[model samples]
Target: MASQLNSGSDLGFEADLFKAADKLRGNLEPSEYKHVALGLIFLKYISEAFSAHYKKLGEEEYADQEDPEEYLAANVFWVPPEARWEHLQANAKRPQINFTDVNTGKERVGDIGNLIDNAMDSIERANAAVLKDVLPKEYGRPQLDKTMLGELIDLFSKVGMHSADGKSKDLLGRAYEYFISQFAGAEGRRGGEFFTPRSVVQTIVEMLEPHHGRVYDPACGSGGMFVQSERFIENHQGRRSDIAIYGQERNHTTWKLCKMNLAVRGIDADIKWNNEGSFLSDAFPTLKFDYAMANPPFNISDWWQPQLEGDVRWKYGQPPAGNANFAWLQHIIHHLAPRGTAGVVLANGSMSSQQSGEGDIRKAMIEGDVVDCMVALPGQLFYSTQIPACLWFLARDKSANGHRDRRGEILFIDARNLGHMVDRTRREFSTSDIATIANIYHCWRAKPDAGLGAYQDIPGFCKSATLEEVRKHGHVLTPGRYVGAEDAEDDGVPFAERFAALTATLEDQFNESDRLTALIREKLSMVRYDV
Candidate 1:
């Protein structure tokens, strides 16, 4: 991991690179361009790994050990002869000639376009499961002009991107991830299709505190949850190696992105891919996870729920087929270990919607003492939808952490007003904001505080509500309704004096407006006389 994030400040490297690539975007949208950029990064990564192994083979000490096995032993995919970075760079200036290459046939090797397809085919054969659908072989399509292909290759070559050191710096990885976020932001609602806000991931990590355990994401998008879990371990002075990661992604392209993202961070994760999501396939049927987190698509309607009518995971109640919110909840509940805790993001309706037997599921979970904490998140936190989101913390046992018995009580945090806008359209919780929310949960869950902030509850901020109180509210989990309105300031001024001062200011403003009107009239009369 690079100690300093080059994407943060004065380093215009990523910005410049993205701008140049965007120029070449031409007729392709950001979503399509994402595949193009990620493929290049993956190509660069494998090529560098191959080059590194090849250099070692050239050394006399390891000359006998220089085989594909040597590279595979180190988790490096074998880059075939024609797919090497040097070979591609040599022909970057001319991306149209059908030069001969022994491996890819006497086909076009001079064109950067053909090289991309050849590389994709080679990688697909090398690692079928991980890279089969990840590489961009369609660059040779009629849409991409030869001149533009050459320009892109030239730009990438100039960035010192061909070397192992450059790829290993983790710079390219961050840049590529940054591009994902940028595209997500650019695409608006569709952005949520593949990306989750980083701050939300951090907040979940901070609260769940997945120090050492199996971390899983059922609807893993680009593996942000897994990456954040690794980051949490490192931040807590714990080794990421102590934790195991497992994930399942329905989208093939997104799954590839997740694999590449994890690979870039050097994190080993077992990611399963299938058209049917966890709902239909149930990848890890018998395995229980220590910590599970996910940001599932909000209000998913076409989840193929009819096929899973009597699923065993529905311990609470059968979720409404029209909405998959409760279904995802039950899935995580079923997958949790005896000592497991999970934090998930869902559409705000899950908190209070009583439609279609959802209220029954909520009541059952509450009665079972599984629902831990509920948080109301602010709007615009996601790129995919403007609908508000909330967080649900589910714990197998409240007594696991030696905290007070919170079975009868649930922590409701009204953080709907928290977070700052990152841009005009999207808002993300800052580091302090994340810490503040996490600290509140930690302090409340501690042996003593469990749900108090400082001394008194900040109005409209947070509150600890008992099961009876929750029942009084009819199982609705919206925090604002329970937390009440925020506190108002006491100016300490007398009512009469304050009223007089306000009246005087209004009178002065009125007099000034009248004088301006008279001056305008005099100016008009003078103009008429002159005419």
Candidate 2:
């Protein structure tokens, strides 16, 4: 296990950058400042990308340097002249601002905030298809301090955001990820809504290995799942173009964040947003995906369950109207392709709860042979809630795909003791912890020739249990039930010698007690005689 938290002075450039940006946050709450800071970072990223492409187009005789289509064709967001980073940086120190609205021909006078707001607008208008309403345009709000905003812009400007030809796209992307994580930590519960902790996301991506085909997340908060899946492909030397991305986010602000988060990483996704959410709206309604991963709002009580009766996604069983835990599970299952696999994060109760037919649904899913594995994770891994959670891994077709036929088997991993505390309140899986868990799954699912080692049951850590064993436990999916207690270490002393020593100690204690009793009786008799 390893710790990810660092002191202000120890965390290198990103940490120092975050601290500097936060100082300028003065009166704004983290919730508000999050948009302010992240919006600028996103703006800087696109501008750099556009500028790098613009320089190349300028050198080519046949290319139109100013053509928006040229940048769009290369999957780059076109930044208009007024919206470029260089222009913004140059104007950061302006004492007074004056600009004419291109659409209305109206003169606007304010400060740097107005300039940034306009820049955000221009970028959106220029790349309407990809960025239509994604960028935040509220920098001109009255509560924001102009001086701090200017300084913040200047601070970001000093950072070398681009290489000569934009080869450092990932550098900015990584920084953006770090910022999102930090903001989540700052915002606490609300932050967890938009961001899944990186370690947890990495574990899922590594286990699923979404190398190709379509990947989807119905509750795609800030698109962390999609980002990690793309990174997984790149890390493993797989072509990112092999997989298409699809997602839906109900929160309007979070939806915008997801779009920018993906765009910064050069990932094209069909991420949709609707107030009705995935349940009522069903954004990717008719599409089946090769892989689906999500960390939906846990145990949501007001998921509009009264309106979801007889919903087509409830193939296993109807989820209780009060809690949407089972609803999320069935929804993910519904969207899985014929041979698709899925990994989902849910409350621990979902694994063993018998309330409102949830247990029955688990039974049906188990009997159907769709449940592949269940991992019981440690607590304190989330910024959202303190509730312990588990990972549910499902496979649509287990007996096919050149893997061993695992129809009646399920792997249970009790990882509640694996991770180390990163801080006083938070815990995260280290690189080694993630690799250990993923290796178990891969070995269990892979063929012998795949080069992953053969899977073996480690007592109290992992166990491959038969369906009958699951049924014997009354359909409870808690990993501790199947994996059993870990074996205790053996001391050098033999059992006979240990027992003899214990008896000797007990005899000495008995003898001492009898001597004390006799002395007390003698003292009492002497007192009686004297009386």
Candidate 3:
């Protein structure tokens, strides 16, 4: 649950820092304590950013340091002196302030908790448009340990090291993301409600390569998908402005976490939340995105309603009320632009289950040719469930839209044997493993110059099968059905040549069957006359 996190080169911190912070958590549940800890981290980042920008402006000739416009232009939150990190930390152990209750309208002596609460209020007031109702203001609650709150402030002081490294302000976000992962592990099943394993999100983002245009996630959880997508653009040296983010989370507290998570990283997104969820209440009903990436809850049974039976998003068919695997898939597919592509995570049963018309829906999608590729992942790759899962890559266009014309072929990758164990119960795909899987996909999509090399099947690892082949196997898209055993002999020959040989063998079998049927009828007629 802890890591040796070093920001830039000159500034670094050990895992002990997080352990110390966790110790201060004391009797508070992670669900409640996350806001307290994360809020302070957010406060630290903005305060430091504003103070640095403020000082730099003051040193410049004819510059106004007090103008909020200057800080807004620089993408830094303008923190009032009373709300600054130094001001809060200086008064962490004690406070001297007259506080008025917003609801009660009465004045009272304030403690350190009330001081911090007022600080959050001032920040939100100054940046009304962006930070409105976004920060947690429950620090004054009696259950919070005032002493422990002061200790947490001390623990997060190490976060200041990030500002010294001269890196992007997003380093704090990395630290924030790591802490969320730890909390997810500690909370077990309940944690899965808001968090997805990092490797899984990384692998999807790498494969999709969502560099530009509108990016979306309907079941966004804690907004990790959006964060990773933005990071992808940053890593590839692309323009961040070229990417616009949109998402929707159903859980209220989880949605708040998503907002703060983005705010710390300085990522602007349109993330919506509603109790009815994405299924019953569509937030972006008409907005088609260029790239959609999501890891929705696995095999949810209560997602359907009577109203959903006739919904237009169910283009393939109406999903049975008992399961919503296809519902999420169809919703994503419906929102894709003409050339948009998406990567979705779902339970392994989605590959071959015929129950409740699921098989018919699979056939419809295959016949329609929206399914671009399927990947079977190793078990324990998720923190939420251990049923095993697969990634479904859907594309609205399979023609040569910058890539080769792949209208009737689907790439199958059996990565079930790839990832290594990261802990006693969970497995993760290493950077090398992710690259191996993603690069093969790119190669299959484009020609030699487009990817690492011209696409070639790796026998046990990947295979590109035609529509006819899928039909032969009853439209089961499991990678295991196409990407043969890993132990299968490799002759260093290309897949097309082997496919041709297999086709000839299939034709011979059909011819022999016809001849035997005629012989049997002739023999049966002879016996009947004798009898």
Please write out the lDDT profile of model 3 over residues 1-531, one tens digit for every residue. Answer: 123443433233434456778889889998788788878888987888888889889999988999999999988899987788887788788845565544355786788799888889889989887788888899988999999988878767655534554476677776688778777877877887789888889889999999899999999988899898988998999978999999998988889889989988889999898999998999999999999999998888888778887899999999888889999999999999999999999888898889999999999999999999999888887776777788999999999657889999999998988999978988989989999999999989985576467889988889999999999989988787688853111232234677888999999999999999999999988884434
Candidate 1 residue runs with Cα over 4 Å from true position: 1-12, 49-60, 63-66, 97-110, 160-169, 402-404, 448-456, 486-531
TM-score leader: 2
How do the residues 1-531 of candidate 2 rate in per-residue lDDT, one tens digit apiece?
Answer: 012211222336677778888989998999999999999999888887888889889999999998888988998888888888888888887878788664566898867888899998888888787789899998888888888888988888766556554455576777788899898988899888899999999999999999999999999999999999998998889998999999999999999999999989989999999999999889888999999999999989888646788888989988887889989988999999999999999988888789889889999999989999998888899998888889999999999756788999999998988899989999999999999999999999998889988899998899999999999989888887788853111221333678889899999999999999999999987884434
Clash pairs detected, candidate 3:
none
* Over 4 Å off, model 2: 1-11, 486-531
Cα misplacement distance, residue 72 of candidate 2 (Å)? 1.7
Preferred candidate (lDDT higher): 1 or 2 = 2
Model 1 CA lDDT for position 375: 84
- Candidate 1, residue 332: the lDDT equals 96
| Candidate 3 Cα errors over 4 Å, as ranges | 1-7, 10-14, 95-107, 486-531
After aligning candidate 2 to the native by TM-score, how far in Å is the CA of 328 from where it should be? 0.6
Clashing pairs in 1: 95-111, 95-112, 98-108, 444-450, 444-451
List per-prediction Cα lDDT, in the order shown: 0.78, 0.87, 0.84
